[model samples]
Target chain A: MNTWEIRFAMGNEAIAEGALAAGARFYAGYPITPSSEIAEIASRRLPQVGGVFIQMEDEIASIAAIIGASAAGKKSFTATSGPGVSLMQENLGVAVMSEIPCVIIDVQRSGPSTGLATKPAQGDVMQARWGTHGDHGIIALAPSSVQECYDLTIKAFDFSEKYRTPVYLMADEVIGHMREPYVLHEAAGLVSRKQPDPSEPGGDYKIFDFERYDDHIAPMPPYGGKYIFRMNGSMHDEAGFGCGASDNADKFIRHYEDKITKNRDDIVMTESYNMEDADYVLVSFGCSARSAMAAMRLARQEGEKVGVLKLMTLWPFPDKEVAAALKKAKAAVVPEMNLGQVASEVSRYNERKIPVIGVNRVDGSMITPYQILDALKGLYLKGLSLKGL
Target chain B: MKQRWEIIFSGVGGQGLLLSGNLLGAAVSVIEKRQAVMTCTYGTETRGTFTKSDVILSDGYIDFPEVLDADVVVSLAQIAYDRYVDVLKPKTLFLYNSNQVKEAPSPARQVGLPMEEMAAQAGAPAAVNIVALGILTALTKCVQPTSIQEMLTRHFKGRQDVLGANIKAFEAGLEEAGK
Candidate 1:
């Protein structure tokens, strides 16, 4: 493993290489803008690495194929945009109920439905958390730079394996298309799913042993192996037999929530920039964080105290840390490519009196640093005073 | 750190400005080992549409990645030149090909060259991008000539079909930029 390999790579290509480095053995995706480059790179690189690359008919089948591949004991993934992700919601629900481990790389674009293919947006911030119906938790990580696109994709896979759940890399077109020189590490820190030892015996070995719900994990037996059991969407017992009892349904939801909610500390991650002794803060993630950093520099230049809280993991949102960071600020600004999706989330945890102002833009253009700086300047001037929050 | 310099190359589709921008970043950031960022956006039409790329070579971190204003802008076609001319700073160094463009934005900012014709004369019309890159490298002094030559050698090494002509055209650009 060469530790010093540097290349001028786009965000999408970096994702494919990162997936390879993380030992992803299968990929199924349909080429869509912003995210199409991931499929293109995977098609070329997966075969060389002795992995399987399947171009499915549509986004639904692409996710379905990866889910099936993951069940069959292969590290699998798929890439899509907002439109495709919308189609994947049903299958994603199916994956969550069955606890199938897989990765989804969603290069987000501006959209309610196919709004802008080439433009960038963070509109999917909430979608990554609540797109699937019913009580289910998902791991979604947003990368702010081309290098993080590589580093976080590997982390996405690791979390998927650790929790036996689906993980998402919610990227936008800005980071997906931008080229930057990055050096890939020799070996990535990885966590594999706990597998049941074959010598431990197949006799009465149940797949869904609920007795271990505190860990929110069960050693999944690969489909092709000798272990024989039933897997279904309906409520199931410890041995994975279909059950309709009220108690079992209650237990199912509890364990489902416990898997993610309990491990929030291990899963939820955020990066703060110049947060020490700052009176104003900017809560942003992904490509918007780049602009927010620039805004922080400008605000500091003007002798104003400002910082940034860059969220890498969108789901299992960090409420405690965010509330604490907002305590010092009279106002916090949320600048995103979308119209205030994450801004609303920031306010929920903002128990402090800090007024979180959202500077939004979804008109097929990126939100520049100047826009954020203007919003920050206007926030304290109009919304609050120094004594507020 | 040297004062941050930005370069944008604009031209018609199929003129290889994207590759030129890529190679320039490869030369300065990779070969010369500096901080660099590169991006390009183009219209839907494959040919006859305006395609351009921007590269910023800085000694340290690049705060804003995109080029809102540039220190040097190379315009290979009349339409692209006309579109981006007004977006220049007061001291921006403008490079244009006189064969494709009829006039300059301003006499002081313009550094006109017969690059397209020189490339065509070298029997590699597609090599005009390399010629412009060489001329920009010389005019801005952003990248060393040796690094540009190394990038060209690494790019066109396998295909002998157009190797000599591209190098010749780049030399012609370098010589013309000196005058």
Candidate 2:
């Protein structure tokens, strides 16, 4: 084992390192701008670590390969950007319904369709939350720094394994390429999903049955294992068989939902700075949080009781903490690279209209500290009291 | 005491921005045993689009990932200078290629180096980034020159000829800074 040490790595390369450190054995991805480097590094590094790296023909196949690899009892992952993520939606949904454990990273660029391949955008925040067509649950983590790129990636894999569902690692172009010093721990803490019991008869091993288990997260067996059950996208029962009954749909949805919702305390992760008795709070995530922190410090120096709330877990939105912050805050500011994604959600909780300010930038540029400071000044000039709700 | 500096390397694609970022990062991380992170961006156009590589080196944990206000912004292209001038603090140093960036200084401490001309003079036109790195270390003392040389040797350990040219280019840059 090696001591913790700081290392320089591009965003893509850092993801590969994180994935490998997390015990990822298979990488299936198609090269795309801003994210191709991830594929490139995986190709070089995965094999060196006795893992497999396959460049699939397209994003669909890439995700499918990971899904299949995960089912074969391997920790698998794939990296993609906007269009590629769009292509993998059906399979992503498939993985959701089948309860497969894997990690999918979207190094988001500007897009509806290749909108801005080289530019940074948080447009996919909503997509990551609700991109699939059905009412399925997901675990999405947004990393603000390169170390988080490595650290959160490990967390993404862990969450995927613990919950038995596909996890999303959302990153923007600015973050994907930006370099920072990060410490690589000698041994990363990883959670591997429980494999099914091999002693049971192959027919008796119900892959999704968990009536006797403690939680909704059903243990699964790899294909070669005794539990050779069929899995599909349709709502299924304990046997992993599609059931059209509405009751079955309820059971199916609740299964994965509980896996995450019940574990909310363990899954929900956030960072707060000077927010305990803050008069005002800033809610921001991803790269924009960097600017928000700088702005908050400046605002505090100017004698404003301002603080910042950074969200690490994007999906299963940290509602409890957010609501508590809002309750104690006079006004809330939501700043994002996107126009109004998180702000829209903040408004729902803030019915008091305590001036939930939205500071947004959609240009191909990263939001700077000046823009954030300007927004604070504008809010102050408007005579909005920075007090508690 | 080990001091860590987060340096943002900005230039256009094909200017070896990512390569330079990697070289500098590898030098610091692999040689000095310091923590380093490097991220790069290349616009759609592979040849003439704006490209940037930001590197943060630290002895402690680097919680924030993005560059807030760069202590040193190295611009090798005109567009890089134009786009990032407003981001640098007053004390921030702007180091640009004398042959490429024909812009005025936006920072209190600014120095333009003849990177292209110097690399050409050193008989390695593609070593502009290395030369610029040399000049940058001299002016800012951001990283030790000897440490960088150690990095250079490790970077080109397998190729002696390329190593020789890069070392030569680096010396030329050091001499230019000395002038």
- lDDT by residue (A1-389, candidate 1, tens digit) is 48767777788988988898889999999989889989998999899989999999999999999999998888999999999999999999878888889999999988889877777888988888889888877889999888899999999999998888999999998888877777777544578778886577865657778466457588887886777756677777877778899998888777777788789999888998889978888999988898888888877887777899999998888887789889877788998988898889899988866778898998877778889877866765784543321
Over B9-72, each residue of candidate 2 has an lDDT whose tens digit, in order, gives 8887887777777877777666766667666667677698888887777775554545665778
lDDT tens per residue, model 1, B55-152:
88888877667786678889999998897666677788888888889775563388778887888887888798988987887677788888887878
Error of 1 at A233 (Å): 2.9
Candidate achieving the largest lDDT? 1
Chain A only TM-scores, each candidate in turn: 0.96, 0.95
The 10-residue segment with the lowest total lDDT in model 2 chain A: A380-389
TM-score of every candidate relative to the true structure: 0.94, 0.90
**Residues A246-303, candidate 2, lDDT per residue (tens digit)?**
9878877777667777788888889999997788888988888877887787778777
| TM-score winner | 1
DockQ, 0 to 1 scale, candidate 1:
0.60
- Every candidate's chain B TM-score: 0.92, 0.90
In angstroms, the error of model 2 at B107 is 8.3
Local error of candidate 2 at residue B4 (angstroms): 9.4
